[model samples]
Target: MALRPLFASLWRLLCSLKLAIVLAAAVTLLGIGGSLVMHFNPGVFGDLDRMILGRWWSTAGSAAPLLSWWVPVGALLLALLCLNTLCCFLDWARRIRYRWRKGGEYLIHLGFVLVLIAYFWGSLAGFRSEGNRLFVGQTLALPSLPGHFLRLEAFEPIFAENGRPVDMLSTVALLHGDNLLARQIVRTNTPLTWKGLAVFPGSFGRTVEGFAVHIAGVGRTSFSPGAELSLPDGLRLRVLNFLSDARRLAGGRVARGSSELGRPAFELELNHPDGPSWRGWYLLAEGPPSALTEAGLLLRPVEPLYRPYSILTINDDPGAALALTGGLAMLAGVLLALVSFYYKRGRGDRPEVW
Candidate 1:
């Protein structure tokens, strides 16, 4: 008999609205504190969205002590709030008979509980891979989704009148071994989804191919931009820069004209063992292969193989559907509650009954 009274008292405490209020307030305060911490120290928390919460805390918690302390406390408070919501709903159901007028209240509590559950579950189980770069015709294996691969078919960027990029489109194909499963165009805001996996086009950039040149003593060789090579007679050759479309300005200066393959040029530097170093630009459009009489270097621009690459982010969120359903249920509950209130007011019915 004494144990029964103790159990009853604990159940009553669990179902108390006061407990719900306390947990909500604690969670709100923790959110405010967390926001402040993240604002001041963005580097520590910037990658949190791309990590699994449970694993991140296990591995990175020690590295970021200032932000780690509140995670567990906030999680505990949210768990208590969920429990309180469930208990209150169950206690209310047990005391009153079923009625359509009270359906809205039940749905609100149920949706709130479901949303919390989804959040906790997703935080522990979600997977995210950010900044996966892929050149055209390159393939990346999806570790989260076994037997699947993402292939970049094409990358096209639309530039504005001033040569600024307005939008970038990436054509991607999803494959399973030798078979093609799906293909879609991924943009900045539009992501490609397949089998719970989301592929978002993060950004794009251009990369150099290589510069073909022939040294006086050494035979033909290809070197990429920023490459340093040792030539015959203790001479060092350095590829300074490469421009796809080189345009000569009025002041005898060269600038990139456009992204297209127009007048390609390679800036070369040759260092002598005991003399002054020589640097000059080799424009491929002027001639085929020419010798730099000053530096005794023969250079030719290789066909401009400027390849554009796309950076993609893949995410596998298991609880996204559940969270969406919960959100819809909450919206429906709010609308129903408002309708019930107005209907009762028009009839002059007792508010206590609702």
Candidate 2:
């Protein structure tokens, strides 16, 4: 008999409207605090975008307690609010008689509960992988989808007259082993989605495709950037860097001037077994600088190849549909309730109590 009274007290507490108001206010306050923290210390919270929320709590969240302590507390309050909503809904359903007008109130409660549940589910199940670099004719295996691969077919960038990129388009194909599943042109706004996986075009940049080198008394050989070569004299030649649209700075340093190709340059490092290594920049526009001739080496640049690439972000969000459904349900419930209110007022009858 004593336990019965305690159970009744717990039930009343669970369905208390005052408890709901307090929880909502606390959640809002915590949200404001989190926003401020993120704005000032973006480096701490920035990793959350690329990680699963459930996993972030143990890693980044634990690493920065002062900034992220409110997240777990807010989540707990949300869970309590969800339970309270559910309890109030059940109490209302049990006491009130069913009517078409009352259906809207039920839907409102259910929708709110579902929205909370969706958030909780998504935080645990959803994941986001950002800044995946994909070059033309290269294939990247999907981390979320097994046996699925994303291949870059082509990339096109439209630049303004001032050399700023106005728009970018990437033609990508989704493949399963040797079979092609789907192909689409993904842009900044238009994301490709398949099997609940979304591929978004994040950004684009240029990369070195290959390099053509000519060694005197030896046949011309093709080399890629960052490749090392062994000379006949047992010297080592390393291609350290390649810059398209290269600009010569005041101190003889090279930098990328613009996106458009102007003067291509290569920074090479020559290593000798018994002597100090030599490093210098060789411009393609000017054939083999005097430094190479002074070193008694016959090396020349034939051509520099470069191409643009696309960075795609893949997102796996399983609770998106649930959230959408909850939003629609809430909208319908509000409209139905408004119509019922007007109808009751027209008839001059007492308005239904919520």
Candidate 3:
């Protein structure tokens, strides 16, 4: 009989609104502190969280087992808050069982519980996201999805008249083995979602690509169309056509205009009496050079051409739907609770709604 009274007292204490408020305040304070600490000291708490929670950790030295003192304390407080919320809900349910007019308050509690459930579920199973910057034709390996890779097929940037980029389009593909699973075009505001992953266009920048030819007397010089050079032996090397961005024209001639500098290329002709005349095309970005050594002369590429590319971020969240649902339910509950509290009332012995 004595134990029964003590149990009731403990249950009341657990179900009290004061306990809930204290726990909530503690969690909020802890979250603020954690955010500040993480902002100042990068990768410390991140590494610790990954190690303890077994979540995806991409930061450098994330494998190091170093935990902050506040992590366990904050976790304990969160667990207690969850328990308190559940106990309060049970108490509320019991009191409101006979009274059907106060259904809105019950809904409010239920929505909060659902939101908490989503948070816990996400913490346990959700993977961290990272951003990747890639050039066209470059492939990036995914850490979360093994045997799956993402490739950048093309990046198109729309520039304003002032030479400033205003919008970007990135085309990417998800491939497993030889099979392509999905293709996505990520835009400025539109994110592409595929296989529980989302790719968002982060930023864009231009890259230069062209051929740097080296001569016997001269160290190195950039070669473009209409460029004429006289060799030390009286022979002549002329760049017949230079295409910063080359595309095949109607008559099979390679040509480029001002807006075609995305893929640089060049075509050259060399005249030497001893070795006759040689002509070939050289693409700056990709493919093998047309001819390295010809006509008793050596012409090699200094470096590959450069082009613009988009930086994309890939993110995954399993609890996104759940969280969104809970948020909507909570909003609805709040509105209903306000209406019920102001309108509904009961007889003596019923506690006041505050």
Predicted candidate 3 versus true structure: per-residue lDDT over 1-354, tens digit per residue: 899999998998887778888889999998888778767766565454433143533333344335344555776898888787777678778877575565666566666777776666666665555447789999988776788888999989988999998888888998886689989888888887764567788887665545677765656876755678877666788887666677656764676756545666678777775766777666655543434344345555676445677788776556667767767877887788687665664333344322
lDDT of each: 0.79, 0.81, 0.69
Write candidate 2's Cα lDDT for 246-326 as tens digits.
Answer: 888899878887756677777888888788888988877777777566666676767666677898998877877787788
lDDT top scorer:
2
Off by over 4 Å in 1: 93-96, 211-299, 344-354
- lDDT measured at residue 99 in model 2 versus the true structure, 0 to 100: 46
Worst 10 residues of 1 by lDDT: 287-296
In candidate 2, stretches whose alpha carbon ends up further than 4 angstroms from where it belongs are 1-5, 93-100, 178-181, 211-303, 344-354
* 2 against 3, candidate with superior TM-score: 2
Candidate RMSDs in Å, in order, are 10.0, 7.8, 10.7
The 10 consecutive residues of candidate 3 with the worst lDDT sum are 50-59
Clashing pairs in 3: 207-306, 208-306, 209-305, 209-306, 210-305, 245-260
Q: Considering only N, C-alpha and C atoms within 3 Å, which residue pairs clash in candidate 2?
A: none
lDDT of 3 at 19: 82
